[model samples]
Target: MDLKDRKRTTRQRLFRSFCCAWAGLTLVVRHEQNMKFHLLAAAAAVICGFVFSIPLFHWMILVVIIGGMLALEVMNTAVERVVDMITEDYHPAAEKAKDIAAAAVLVYSAAAVVIGILIFYEPVMSRLFS
Candidate 1:
């Protein structure tokens, strides 16, 4: 292929990939309960950050934490779906895989909560006390 053709192909592929990724995200948002909860939590965090007028550094931290959490939840859903696809019947290995994936999200969620508290506690206290 000519250079022009190659560049066009690459751009097309990139656009297609982005479309697929967005579809996956919409699927999760529409069908996954956990993802819905994560979305709500993310929204709440962003709103609270604005309400508190959090610093740029804190905003960065919140962004990372929230993005990591949503990503992890999506991964967990993928894992669960793959496990179910592999076996319709109950299996210890499948159960373990699902549990481990879920545990990862759970651990990250706990950390996110702690980070949220750390970030918001001072601002909330100051607002109330002042």
Candidate 2:
């Protein structure tokens, strides 16, 4: 291909990447209700990070835990949706599968909560106590 053609192809590729990113963002926005609580928690953590001037390591841990919990919640929601679609009526096996997926999200959420409390409680308590 000529140089001009190569440049055009590169521009097209970049445009496609940008479009894909926007689409993914749109999907996240559309599914906000499924993960609203986790998003709220993440927002709270970010605000607290700025308010407390948390160190990099603490922020890193918070980010990892929050990301994991959000990912798990999203996966759980997907699994539940698929299961429901496959079996519209109530069934023991479907219930068990849905319960398992929910439990995974709950476990990650609990872990994230504990990490948040540990990371923020000291700063919060000092502010309140002193």
Candidate 3:
């Protein structure tokens, strides 16, 4: 192919990738209640940061926590879907794969919540007790 044609093909490929990603997100949102909850929690965290006037570093930490949890959730969903596709029948290994994926999301989410509490404790306590 000519250079111009190659460039056009590359652009088309990139666009298709983005479209697929968007479709995946839509599928997850439609089927995963946890994703909706996570998004709500993330919004709440951002609002809390604004309300308490958290510093840039704190905001960055929150961003990491929020992004990490959401990413993990998406990964967990992907793993579960793959496992399901492999076997509609019950299988121990498939169960284990799904369970492990879920556990990772749970573990990370729990840690994120604890860290958020720790970071916001003083500010929240003072605001409430003052």
For TM-score, candidate 2 versus 3, the one ahead is: 3
Q: Which digits, one per residue and each the tens of the lDDT, describe model 1 over residues 1-130?
A: 3355455677786777788789989988899999999999999999999999999999999999999999999899999999999999999999999999999999999999999999999999999999
Q: Which stretches of candidate 2 lie over 4 Å from their true place?
A: 1-25
Best by TM-score: 1
lDDT of each: 0.94, 0.82, 0.90
Number of backbone clashes in candidate 3: 0
TM-score of each: 0.93, 0.77, 0.90
Candidates 1 and 2, the one with greater lDDT: 1
* lDDT (10s digit) by residue, model 3, range 26-124: 988888999999999999999999998888999899999999998899999999999999999999999999999999999999999998998799889
Question: Where does candidate 2 have its weakest 10-residue lDDT segment?
Answer: 1-10
Q: Sorted on TM-score, highest at the top, how do the candidates line up?
A: 1, 3, 2
Q: Rank the candidates by lDDT, best first.
A: 1, 3, 2
